[model samples]
Target: MRISALLIDDDPILRSGMKGLLSMVAPEVEIVAEAEDVQSGIAAIEKWKPQLIFLDIQLNDGTGFDVLEHFTQSTTRLESQVVFITAHEQYAVKAFRFSALDYLLKPVDPDDLRSVIEKVKKSQDDATGISHVELLLENIKRQTNSFKRIALTNSDGIHLFEIADIIRCESEDNYTTFYIRNNKPVLVSRTLKEFEELLRDHGFVRIHQSHLINLTFLKSYVKKNGGYVIMADQTHLPISQRNKERLQELITKTL
Candidate 1:
């Protein structure tokens, strides 16, 4: 396929190197345009309408997330395959993996870049690929320590859930079953710790290694059976001895 691409990054050296690498590795992909900042990136995206975008996370003018927010909110609604290129090594990367979004770490390895290009091509052809982008955009819009939605992948496809609607999560081996409001419980192929890291700041507590509960849905703590939490749905979940004191503190604060 003749893939048209836009490179949006603050570092001229990195962009130039990437251009050369892309030319060598994926000659079919044509560099349509390049931008050094979020504003120009948005302008280029609107004007060029490229098939792929190599987006940098940080820019002098604004973060790459700013550019994505613009496109997401725009009425015209342009969808392009995005491969985030960043130096940031943190929670954002975990979110990317959870959402099935593609990202390249800096300093970019030629082999990894080539692999990402191939993945982008494959993702471009998949019907569900764009949904991952939408999920990532939703996550990017959230403030630190606060999130409104979570995207989970099931056999059918990606499922989006409002954080407020989720009551609790239970671990079963590698899978975590999310108990949600007005919907059947959805099982996702991920560990509980992964979710704990993403949701800890957003009022989710790990009452036990196998469970994570949203504080909003917590009704009361029962002293019986060691210690247990009563969710809004009246389901009883055990609280770990190690986490008991911490959960109590949170419940007190919530009350």
Candidate 2:
């Protein structure tokens, strides 16, 4: 079967260029539709139901995680495989762990695209049409946003945190404290603002000046208590009344 694919990204140059790249490299793959943002992407996925999707981690409207939420929470099952295309270097390793069939870093090399396409095609051939999507979906959703890197410090020295074991980041007097999965919060040299700036590009958002929580690590939020968010590890963080509107906007825009 000719593999049908959808391309989603906000960069005009990259999006247009990528469509051309696919046409040249994987001639067998049909470009069925294109979406610049999450909602349209979701609509395209539902309409065309392509075999694969070339996705960008950031879109004008929201991040790739938002697009993913649509797929993960949808009633109509998604069977399309995903190929992540991104310019952000930090997210490469995270992409692989997220079970993306393939990834193309920005200013994509045609050769890389072709080689990965071949690999995916071979996997499809081996599967006799069945894919690992169902089995891997839960893990993908659970871990996609949980991967967080932290700069941990104590009386002795500095240490970089393991991404998977992170709990949350909280603003202190001048530093941002990292609360690990099971361990106590470790203060980092950089202020919470600095960390927020660093992570904002990677889907992290500030609910309150003192708290930068990963939406992917979210468990629940209280609407009545001036909106306090409860994370996956059951950590309660205050959401500033002023930022509540923007936070709600972000929450809606992502998923």
Candidate 3:
């Protein structure tokens, strides 16, 4: 299947290199237009209405974020899938992860690019909801440490949840089940390890190999028989010895 695409970047060399790489790896992705800045990028998008966009985070006139904002705030809906190409911007990267948006780090790797292309193909069949993009924009507007929303994608669809609403997470192999307040549990395909990294700073602790709990939802830590924690929903989850001390330290800090 041929995918119409636009490349928006300030560096002509990088744009040329990406075009070359795409020709070799993703021959189906046809580059319809290229732009060097926010205005031209927006103009190209309006003209081509490409199926995919490879956007640079930093442009000559304005950032790629400016381009997205221009469309997101307008009456027109951006139906195209965006892949942000960026250097090491830690805060922006975290926001993208929280929003469940796709991004590529510079300089791009062939394997990673191929993986992204595969994801794009899969997304075509099961398109992600526009809520993901809205959540991404919301996250970008907040202080990194104060990001309040997260997007979780499963077979059913993408779910937007307030970070504080999550009670705990349970792992079964590569999947994680999120227990939320006043909502049904959400099963996500992503690994517990991935969530552990993403949510650790937001008052979440991996108490065991199979259990991650939100500190705000922790009811009590029971020491009878074996150590375990009681959650807001009264579900008991075992605590592993390896993480016991860390949990205790965090609990003390919270108190």
Candidate 4:
């Protein structure tokens, strides 16, 4: 399939360079539109729903993420994937983690462009770009030891859930609900599978397809009549036969 693309950059020279690189690297890919600022970018996106977006971190009017938020809002579902082109060192590393999409440094090189194209191709096949992104973010979190809390938003506003306070992750339909400390669960619009991979190092276990519990919060294990974990909440999580052994092994090590 031919990939459609949009370019959002304030620098005319850089945007031209990226357009030229993408055209040369993947002739099949086509640039449908270009924008110089956040407002124009959003308007162009609304006009042309491209498959991929080449986002610049800094725009004339606002930051690139601000541009992203306009689409992520109710107006647009952020249908296309984003590949940020940025010079901000602080967010460059974090960018790759938040959005698994590739990024090119300032003064874009043909070699870097080629590599990013290859990564995008790989993502097109894996269909797990978001998962990989989350894993990358989790890895970053481990390395930086920053923000040991999860942010949640509901009708009232936004709330922060301490990572230590969460017992486990549970999936219902398309959302992942966090079981926290004596509080109502925080409902986020993601799957348990995603969180399971995101919190792998944080003692989360997918004992069942529908449940991902924090083994750290586990209180007791019952072995009779198929196995189940009894968490501190007194909530029982059934363990599939296939996972019983692995769960036991992890529990042993944690003890």
Candidate 5:
């Protein structure tokens, strides 16, 4: 399927570069229009109704977030898959990951751009994209360092879960199974190490190589033969010898 795309960036050179990259990597994507600022970007979006949007997070007049918020707060639903473009802002990158949104770092890499296009082609669900944007907007609106919700994509579909509701994550090779409160386990294709890094500051700790647990749902720690943690769901997960002291310190601080 041919994809119509709108490019919104303040920098002409970067826009030209993106156009060139898209042409070379994904000939199927056509640049319908281009805008250099928030208002112009919003106007182009309203006029063209493109299938995909390459949105720069920072613009002269306002940010790309302003453009998305305008449409989100209006009666029209944003149906295009949005790929956020930005310089390396650590917090912004984290927000995108938490919301399961696609992003490209500035001085965009061809491989990353191609990956985004491939994902857009595979999942053309407009609702999924809009929901991710909404989650992203909500996360940003909270004005907190910690993310309240996380979007997890499985073979079934993308599922949004409250971060606090996740009891634990069990890893099996490259797959991680999320055990949530009042929800069935969600099997995700990402490795445990990735999640550990993303969730470490949000009260999730890696007690073992295969286990990441939410401190909020931790019931107690038992130190019989070896250290183990009891989750609110009543699951017993072992704590590695190396992580036992760290877990104890965290538990002590929490108390």
Candidate 6:
């Protein structure tokens, strides 16, 4: 399916470059509208109702957060998949990852942009984009503390879950299985490391290479034979020696 996308950035030169790159690498994504500031971006989104957006974190009048917040607070749901473009370093990129949002660095790498486009296409849950964006906006506003929702995508589709409901994640080679409350576990086509990167700061700990546990569901710590943890689900997972100290630290601070 051809994707109608909006470009929102303050720098005309960067926008021009990105447009050229998109035409070259992601021809399936057509630029439907362009805006240089928060107000114009919001207006473009309202008017065009594009399926995708290339948003700059910084704009002339206000930050991209302002634009997202406007859509989030609006009565009508915002129907768009956002891919943030920014020059900010580690912290901001971490923010996007934690929210499970796609983002590209400035001077937008062609391969990276292509990968992101492919991911968006594979998602196939366009109807839930608005809720995903809203969750992302909420996560950004609260940072690591308010990780209320998480998006998991697989062959079935994108599934959103309350952070508190997730018990733990078990690795299946390239895939990760998310164990949740009152629901069967979900197997997503992503690495345990990817989930670790996204969830580590949000009340999750990688106690072992194959396991990422939500501290909220931690039931007990077993201190025998390299140590292990008992989750609220009653499953026991080993704690790698490398991660043992850190896990203990987090456990002490958390509980």
Alpha carbon lDDT of each predicted model: 0.82, 0.70, 0.90, 0.71, 0.90, 0.84
For residues 77-114, could you state the per-residue lDDT of candidate 6 as single tens digits?
87778889999667677667656678999889999999
lDDT value for model 6? 0.84
Tell me how many clashing residue pairs each candidate has: 0, 1, 0, 0, 0, 0
Instruction: Report the lDDT tens digits of candidate 4 across residue range 1-255.
Output: 587889999999987888788778777678899999989998887789777788887899987667765543444555666677878575355435333345778888888877776666645533222333344344344544343655454344345556678897788998878889879877866677767765666677889888888887899999987889899888988898888888999999987
lDDT of 4: 0.71
What lDDT does candidate 4 reach at residue 153?
Answer: 40
Per-residue lDDT tens digits for candidate 1, residues 88-185, read: 76667866754656789998888998888777776665433446667776666555545566778766667888878889999999999999999999
Model 4, runs deviating above 4 Å: 125-145, 148-255
**Weakest 10 consecutive residues of candidate 4 by summed lDDT:** 125-134
Greater-TM-score candidate between 1 and 6: 6
**What tens-digit string does per-residue lDDT give for candidate 2 at 91-179?**
44343433323578878999999987886685552221112233233334444455434334344343555555555788778876777
Q: Candidate 6 regions off by >4 Å?
A: 124-128, 145-148, 155-158, 223-227, 244-255
Q: Candidate 2 regions off by >4 Å? A: 98-101, 125-255
True-structure Cα RMSD, model 6: 2.9
For residue 15, give model 6's deviation from the true position in Å. 0.7
- Which lDDT tens digits does candidate 3 get at residues 1-255? 999899999999999999998998899999999999999999998889889999998999989888888886777668788899999899999989998888999999988898999899888754333687778878989988899999998778888999999999999999999999999999987899989998998999999999999999999998886799999999988999999999999999998
Query: Which residue pairs clash within candidate 6?
Result: none
Displacement of the residue 233 alpha carbon in candidate 3, Å: 0.8
Which pairs of residues collide in candidate 4? Answer: none
Candidate 1 has its poorest 10 consecutive residues by lDDT at 122-131
